[model samples]
Target: MTVRMFMGDARVDAIAPDDRGLAYGESLFETMRIHRGDIPWWDAHMARLTHGTQRLAMPLPDATRMYAEAMALLDGADGVLKLQLTRGGGVRGYAANSDAAPFWMLSMHPLPNRIDSLDTIWCEITLASQPRLAGLKHGNRLEQILAANEVRAANADEGLMCDGAGRVIAATSANFFALIDGHWQTPVLDACGVAGVMREWVLAQVDAHVTSLKPSDVECADAVFLCNAVRGILPVQRLGARAWPRTHPEIRALQAALAQSHPGFEPLLEAS
Candidate 1:
């Protein structure tokens, strides 16, 4: 991993110990797929970031300068780029310090390991309903962390999480989609869950529904997939004892379509 830090626009050596992001999780982030030093979904990520900053009352970084630095950090490498924006340092309290500058970091990480198909488990950790924060990629992710731990303990690549009402929300780290009766359906993010960039792209590409999902819906679906900006589209081969075909036709078709539209996901199409 490689990182560069900035406070507002100037370079920074380290995050202050009292940074709001560390003190109270007062921050947001966007993880993007970098292909040959360029981000194909830059616009989508930026839009989400802008929306998040507005909601949280945080300052938006200078995009042109950020991109230039990101490319320099990527150095023509194909990998993951994580952009984190914090509300800057605080003075040991929850009250807003309106004068503080925004603190941001850009880091590059190696590509995620390729999994032919994901083996998943249904996590017992339920997401809390917080509509105000729903659909935003905020820094506080204790729920996902706990759920991912459950997945690891179960020896599954990912875990399906649900809200307290038992409505399926999403996977530990990605958006969830299932094929039901020839239609693509994903859980609604009105209550909780991050609305991923790839999910937005997929929704635009296919006729899909954003609605409530039951566990039975997932179990009985024709096929399932997990998506994130970093990992284009990941087919789910097994969830608990239920198994889906390794060669799901819709999965392959979607992957191909995504690759055609985004150069970053092109390699995934051939492999899928």
Candidate 2:
């Protein structure tokens, strides 16, 4: 995979070995989809990135230069773009010095093959409550990595994670939503989970509610689905012993709504 490294105003071929982000996961990243050479939600992604940098007290590289480099790297191809920003090189401790220059990287990868439906599993790796980093998409992703491993073991497409108290949080790499009693409901990310970009769009496009949901609530819902910026929206066909009918109206409506908003998801609606 080809990667372009950025440190302050200069670009390099590779990341420094002693970077803090590499040592302690002290970084933030955003995975975005490029369609016809344009990143539809670039502004939103950058807004979240800036928010994360501010919260972490980390410096941000030049946005204009970063955008230029990213676009140049895209080269008019439609694919996934990942931006990783680290706290640069640091002397071996948790005590942040605040003076270190930030190191950032931009890499482009092939998009995952499109699937009509996703089979999800309820993971056993419970999310610990951490309000300080609740909504930001930080690099401390061991929980998600573990949950995804469980998903692979279960032969499922993705894993649904819950808090230590058993309240549903999110999918391993996406946010979850379910239809219950004709209403769209999703778990609140107040105490855990990443607030996904596609999730924010869905909340605006549909009449969705954020509430604390139990595992049984998801299992007994009228229909269930997951959403992420990269893959758009996905319908869940099965979760554990429970299976949902493919033609659930709520699911179809959500897919249609997504298609109307983003042409990239139109293929998904057709496949569904």
- Please give each candidate's TM-score: 0.96, 0.96
Alpha carbon lDDT of each predicted model: 0.89, 0.88
Cα TM-score of candidate 2: 0.96
* Clash totals for all candidate models: 0, 0
Q: Could you give candidate 2's per-residue lDDT for residues 1-272 as a string of tens digits? A: 76899888888777788899989999999999988777888888999999999988889998998898888888777789999999998888897765877999999998889997889889999999999999999999999999999999988899899999999999999998988988899999989999999999889978888999999999999888899999988889898889985747767777787777777676444443
Which parts of model 1 have CA positions greater than 4 angstroms off? 267-272
Residues 9-46, candidate 1: write the lDDT tens digits: 89999999989999999999999988887887888999
Error of 2 at 108 (Å): 0.5
**C-alpha-based local distance difference test score of model 2:** 0.88
What's the CA error at residue 252 for candidate 2, in Å? 2.2
Model 2 weakest lDDT span, ten residues long: 263-272
Taking all chains together, the TM-score of candidate 1 against the true structure is 0.96
- In Å, residue 93's CA in model 2 sits off its true spot by 0.9
Any idea how many clashes model 1 has?
A: 0
For candidate 2, the C-alpha RMSD (Å) to the true structure equals: 1.4
